[model samples]
Target: MSDDGVRWLDEDQQHHWRALVMGTTLLFDRLDNDLSREHGISLAEYEILVRLSEREGRRMRMAQLADSMAHSRSRVTHTVGRLEKSGLVERIKSPEDGRGVVCAMTEQGWELLVAMAPTHVRGVRDNLVDLADPADFAAVGRVFDAVADHLVAAHPEMEIRGH
Candidate 1:
């Protein structure tokens, strides 16, 4: 390594970071896997539904949706198409922009979200929230906020929504 005075991660910090990442990843893996198996929906599909359900008229512009979901335009397009086929979403021309498209949650999609929200919440609490103490959980929230801010500052052109 270059003799730059920049110090590497301390052993404790490295171990802590690795454990945090691996543990969270494994938790999400199990949650998503079980969710998909039981509910016939993947985590991505659930997130899309949640986004649409929370939007005005359960609708949002394609670009905004992509931003909210942290997905590329093409990936969002493909996923939206699949959701549309499953009768969980609908796509239409944007009223605000002539050349743009929008994604809206359908009646079936709302029903699905309503059905799954409770189970999903339980899975989240069980896998992550309940496992962390209050102080640690608060710290985790702050960490995510800082990370998101850093990312936004680094990539001003990329639309990334935390809310």
Candidate 2:
């Protein structure tokens, strides 16, 4: 503890922390920009589509989608609204429940996702994956898994795991 009675990062810890922050920021920006430039869709929108595609029927309740993405319902709704306008996805009353709405990807959305997946994957490879050794990349995954586990345990009500 320092004079202020607060534990602080040492010089090496500070360096690594800053690198993590900057690297993630730049990496996400680059990935988002790549998707936006080539596919006319933001990374967030693409991610929503991906989540739906992986579901049993390519559909998910709006609330579940929001929870899976760790985004607010309103934010997800707003993005879905834009996607709906673009004819990429549709919102309908859930079949199991008349009250909850479900977001389903349209055929057009699936086609778009199939086409643009390569671009996103290439960006990830070029920007990050290929830059690291295999072992180091695996270590990164382990680090994040630990971080995610800690955070999820700290906030069990968030229900942000296992989509």
Candidate 3:
């Protein structure tokens, strides 16, 4: 209680931190590999499809989409460009604002999402959900929810949208 101000993690804390890092890294790696093999799409592309599908009119403003996906605007632009070439998504000038742009899911994209959802869900359950203790799983949700809240609060200018 009288040190010069660094609160370092002890052995137990270090173990938990490493466990979380390794678990998430491995889980995402497996998920990405599965998606690429089974659907010819990366996990990042699948996430973009899912988000657009969930939006009204299946569209979101470009900047809003980037913020929602935790990607930089330039990165989102590049991904959207790739998706566009794949015929899964399209970009258009926003109807309400001439200078703004929006990304929309195409019919092909929606069809792909419908076909891929089950496989992804099962993979998720097998790899993480079913393996976690029920109570610990609930705690995990709370931890991430709090972290998301803190991040969103800190960056109020990020312009995330419910869509």
In model 2, the Cα lDDT at residue 26 comes to 98
Compose the digit string of candidate 3's lDDT tens values, residues 49-86.
99898789999999988888878999989988989999
Candidate 2, 73: how far from true, in Å? Answer: 1.2
Instruction: Please state the error at residue 9 of candidate 2 in Å.
Output: 0.6
The lDDT ranking, best first, is 2, 3, 1
Per-residue lDDT of 1-163 in model 2, one digit per residue for the tens? 9999989999999999999999999999999999999999999999999989988778999988887777899999999999999999999998996999999999999999999899999999999999999999999987886886686655332333442
Runs with alpha carbons beyond 4 Å of true place in candidate 3: 1-4, 154-163
Candidate 1, residue 148: the lDDT equals: 65
How many clashing residue pairs are found in candidate 3?
0
Q: Report the error of model 3 at residue 125, Å.
A: 0.4
TM-score of each: 0.88, 0.92, 0.91
- Model 1 per-residue lDDT tens digits across residues 1-163: 3389777888898999999899979987877886787788888888889888877799988888887766898898888898999999999998886788989899999998899888789998988899889999999888877786687664322333344
Candidate 2: residue 105 lDDT (0-100): 96
Q: List the residue pairs that clash in candidate 1.
A: none
> Could you tell me the lDDT of residue 42 within candidate 2?
97
lDDT of 2 at 122: 99
Ranking by TM-score: 2, 3, 1
Each prediction's Cα lDDT score?
0.83, 0.90, 0.87
Candidate 2 residue pairs that clash = none
Can you tell me which runs of candidate 2 are displaced by over 4 Å?
154-163
